[model samples]
Target: MYLSLLTLNSRSKRALTESSRPYELHRSLLKAFPDAADGGPGRVLFRLDVNEQTGSISTLIQSEKKPLWTRINGYASFVTECKCKEFKPALSLDQIFRFRLRANPTKRMKSTGKREGILNTTEQVEWLRKKGMNNGFEIIDVIALDEGFVKDKLTDTDNTGHNTNMFSVRFDGLLKVTDVDVFYSTLRSGIGSAKGFGFGLLSIAPIKE
Candidate 1:
């Protein structure tokens, strides 16, 4: 496992295009690991953090072997820096940490027989609550950013010939690791749906003692 951070100028047109079309960005990111280009179980999980004025991309890549090369392009400056390091956390039961996640919270509407995103603030919170339980973590304190969530229309068209809509919510909270193995799996495989569109990358930091 490798953790990587890429800082991009929000004003750059190429950055804007890559941000809008997550599929394109995914392909671009995979360029680093040629072995995974054809697609496999081992892949990269990425999240885009953006504000009204600033943005950055963080990714967790899983590869059995070291990548042939890692590179990034399309930035305001000629050199687009990408920092990477081995990701190996020594986790234990009841270990507390501060966590941040950009997730797509959704539920299938039985009435409509269609998968629908959770939009209400209360529902959004509940969605995360359930996810935490299933993922082997307990949320001690959590808050939703951007007024619960934001909606994004994917720039690339899907099989239906229509843009896919993604509902993204940022979660900030303190969590205690319950099941170490399960938690590790959650960290690798990610949470929820629409992972390709920059959703479901869970990141964490140690809590100060």
Candidate 2:
């Protein structure tokens, strides 16, 4: 797997425009890997982080293939720095790490067969707990930050004229790996839904004691 960090120049008009539109931003990131197709091998996952106070923008991208960010035209001017590195996590059973996941916390309504965002904070935390159980991790301690809704309009070839509102929540905490194999898969495949629109990328670091 490969991980990339792109620090964008928030002051640039093009950067600001794409940042506001998730679909456009996703398209922009895909320029890094011209040969890769969505939902195919080498699937790309990304998360956009914006510092409201500082007006700074940065994005983290994870993929099965290495990305050549320079392939994108004029992308260098929009970014202050771009870094990509190989990511291979050496995890053991019962190993603990600090983790952050920006996910779309939701549940499907049985009657309507449609998914709805979990609005309550407690329920949001429970959502992550359930995910950890199935994903081969145990949540030792965690908190959910309600990031509200991310509105996106699809202008792409297939989904043109479609609009979507995705509720986003940031989960941060310490978790212990219960199954190394399963945990590694979770890290690569990510967690939750709406992955294409900047949700479900899990970032973690070993805890230093």
Candidate 3:
């Protein structure tokens, strides 16, 4: 596993567009690994860092071979820096860590059998509660950050050809790793849905002893 951090040029239009749409960014990330196929289950998890001024991307890419930094044309200039390092995962039972994740909280409607996002704060928290239970972790002092709809240049046909609205909620808290295996899988595969659109990337830091 390799973790890469890329600093992007914010002024570039292509950068702005790609930053807004997770689907496009996924494609952009694949360019780093020439051997990776364009379509299939992805081995990469990415999250954007946006502030008042600039934005950056941090990606956890799983590959046996080192990746080559590939830039998109006309979209933006090449990444300012591609910092990469070999990653080795270490875990222990009942370990606590400071965690952060941008997740798309949603559930299926029992009546219409349709998938809808949970935008309500109480419901979103409940959704996370259930998710944590199933994923073998517990949230301690978690707060949710609302990041409204993420509109893309293209509309989703399944969504009545309307702009696919993704309700992004950022979760920050201290968590105890219960089931080591499940926690690892959650970190790799991500939490809820809309992963392609930048929803489910789990970031964590060891608690200072």
Q: What's the CA error at residue 103 for candidate 2, in Å?
A: 0.4
How do the residues 1-209 of candidate 3 rate in per-residue lDDT, one tens digit apiece?
Answer: 66777776666676677777768877777666654364443467777766755345434444334566764443237466667787666889889989888888988999999888888988888888889889978877688888887766554656554457777888888888889999888877778887777777787888997
**Where is the poorest 10-residue window by lDDT in model 2?**
34-43
Q: In model 1, which regions exceed 4 Å deviation? A: 9-11, 36-41, 54-79, 146-160
Model 3 stretches astray by more than 4 angstroms:
36-42, 53-65, 71-76, 154-162
TM-score per candidate? 0.82, 0.94, 0.84
Weakest ten-residue segment in model 1 by summed lDDT: 70-79
Those runs of model 2 whose alpha carbons end farther than 4 Å from true positions after fitting are 36-41, 156-160
RMSD of each: 3.4, 2.0, 3.5
Model 2, residue 126: what's the lDDT? 89
lDDT of 2 by residue, 21-88 (tens): 87788888887784534544367889998899999999999988888888776876888899999999
lDDT of each: 0.71, 0.89, 0.73
The sequence of per-residue lDDT tens digits that candidate 1 reaches over residues 104-166 is: 788889899888878787888888888989998998999986433333444445444445666
Between prediction 1 and prediction 3, the one with superior TM-score is: 3
